[model samples]
Target: MIRGVRGATTVAENNDVEIIKATDELVKEMISKNHIAATDVAQVLISVTNDLDAVFPAAALRKIEGWSFVPVMCMQEIPVPNSLRKCIRVMMTVNTSIPQENINHIYLGNAVSLRPDLKAE
Candidate 1:
């Protein structure tokens, strides 16, 4: 069955290094925590707040050997009052036998507070 894993992270700076690091951490955590196999991942969509412009965060994931073929896309998040800045959010579509409740969602950095209901143990 196909399922989606959602993750959100933030960058303290707009530099390329920060962007790549945060994105890499968020993506890797989501994949690892859920024990997601690369072949099971169909597509990944990333969105960044308007405050970011680090030449597309997905470029960094391309450096990972196993993730080379995974289709990735980036988009600009809509600006909303008092919204988080330098935030990168991802929606990954994957084929998994696990039920929805078994999937893990990652919210890192400043995004951790976004979903206090799902706080990690």
Candidate 2:
């Protein structure tokens, strides 16, 4: 079976270092919480708010030891009026047997307000 694990995080500024760091942290947490291996990931789709464009979030995934071959794409998030700024979002599609409701969706930093219902404990 295939499932999508979602996650989002915010960075303090629109810089390459900060974007990479936050993306790495967010993806790692999502993988850890879901007990997913790099090989299990089919693809990763990342999006950043309009204010964040210093770097492509996919760069962070490539730095992971076993994620060199994992397909990744980075794009800009829709500029919704008055929406959260400096936010990075990720959706990882993986081959898993875990039930939908049991899958962990992580939201960190100020992004937590984006999805309070899925906030990790």
Candidate 3:
């Protein structure tokens, strides 16, 4: 069965370095926590908030080793009132047998507040 893993992280700044660092951490965390390999990931879709125009999240994702085959897309997250800033969100579609409930979703920094119910213990 195919499954999807969701994750989000907040960058300390909109600069290229911080943007890539935070996004890289979030991607690695989501994959490692779920014990999924790069080969298993079919595609990745990422969106950044309006405050994060310094770079494209997809470009950062593609820099991961062995991810050349992974299809990645970057888009702008719909702005809303009082939404989190400098946020990068991702949805990874993977070919996995894991049940939906077993999938791990990652949220870091202030982005954790975006999904408080998924907050770690």
Instruction: Please tell me which predicted candidate would have the highest TM-score against the true structure.
Output: 2
Compared with the true structure, all predictions reach lDDT values of: 0.89, 0.93, 0.87
Cα lDDT tens digits, model 1, 1-121, are 9999989999888989999989998988898888887888999999999989967999877976688899999999999989988899999999999898877889999998778676543
Candidate 3 residue pairs that clash: none
- The TM-score of candidate 2 is 0.97
TM-scores of the models, in the order given: 0.95, 0.97, 0.93
- Candidate 1 differs from the real structure by a C-alpha RMSD in angstroms, to one decimal, of 1.1
lDDT (10s digit) by residue, model 2, range 1-121: 9999999999998999999999999999999999999999889999999998888889999998999999999989999999999999999999999999999999999999988898765
In the range 23-117, model 3's lDDT, one tens digit per residue, is 89999898788887889888899999998888887777778888888989999999998888888999999998878887888999888888887
In model 1, which runs have C-alpha deviations exceeding 4 angstroms?
Answer: none
lDDT-wise, the better of 2 and 3 is 2
In model 3, which runs have C-alpha deviations exceeding 4 angstroms?
Answer: none
Question: Regarding TM-score, does 1 or 3 come out ahead?
Answer: 1
Best by lDDT: 2
